[model samples]
Target: MGALKTSKRSDLKNCLTKCKLFRTDVTGSRLYNQRA
Candidate 1:
């Protein structure tokens, strides 16, 4: 049970990181487009 909980927490953290990275990429592309 403890292991499962830890795994879930790690998965949630990974998902959050992925979302942040995706947002950054989208904003970066927008900035690049504006510059071009």
Candidate 2:
């Protein structure tokens, strides 16, 4: 039961990190293309 909780927490953290990275990548690309 304890291990399961830890795994779940890790998964949640990973998901959040991926979401943040994707947002940053999208915004960065938009800004880059606008300059051209």
Instruction: Please give the clash total of every predicted structure, in order.
Output: 0, 0
Report the lDDT tens digits of candidate 2 across residue range 1-36. 999999999999999999999999999999999998
Candidate 1 ranges beyond 4 A from true positions: none
* Per-residue lDDT of candidate 1, residues 1-36 (tens digit): 999999999999999999999999999999999999
- Please tell me which predicted candidate would have the highest TM-score against the true structure: 1
Model 1 reaches what TM-score against the true structure? 0.97
RMSD of 1: 0.3
| lDDT (0 to 1) per candidate | 1.00, 0.99
**Cα RMSD for candidate 2?**
0.5
What value does the lDDT take at residue 8 in candidate 2?
100
